[model samples]
Target: MDVAGIARIATEMTDFSTKEAVGIAVLKKAIDINAAGALALIEVIPDNSQSAPNLPLNLGRNINTIA
Candidate 1:
């Protein structure tokens, strides 16, 4: 996750705006910060497989367009 990487993502995302895309970009930045260390940019926990409390709300759905 270097400046070049961020710029590349930005260029690709210029076509349209999406929350997911933005979130990915943010994670990329975090990973780049600690390139030499173990940077946990993302944690893929299976849905309904883990037990945790006070988790953030997930819409569990996606909107194609703003109506």
Candidate 2:
């Protein structure tokens, strides 16, 4: 899903009495978005970048850790 869609879902999932659901949803969505963005960045890297292959995996790990 796109960032806007994720944001909308996060907003809709929120309840005034309990913030945990909303917080978790938002955090997960943010991590997903970040991972996607990191992959995109890796794709756009110049062919000379030798470490490009590991970028997405590292980013995924970092984002997962956050979630």
The lDDT of each candidate is 0.68, 0.75
Model 1 over residues 1-67: C-alpha lDDT tens digits?
9999999899878845676788899999988887735435344445542554455455445576876
Model 2 lDDT per residue over 18-55, tens place:
58867889999999999999999998986633656756
Model 2: pairs clashing at backbone N, Cα or C within 3 Å: none
* Candidate 1 Cα lDDT to native: 0.68
Backbone clash numbers for all candidates listed? 0, 0
After superposing candidate 2 on the true structure, give the runs of residues whose Cα lies further than 4 Å from its correct spot.
1-17, 49-67
Any runs in candidate 1 off by more than 4 Å, and if so which? 1-17, 36-67
- RMSD for each of the candidates: 18.7, 18.4
TM-score of each: 0.28, 0.44
Scored against the true structure, residue 26 in model 2 reaches a CA lDDT of 93
- For model 2 the local lDDT of residue 16 reads 44
Q: lDDT winner among the candidates?
A: 2
Mark the 10 consecutive residues where model 2 has the least summed lDDT.
Answer: 56-65
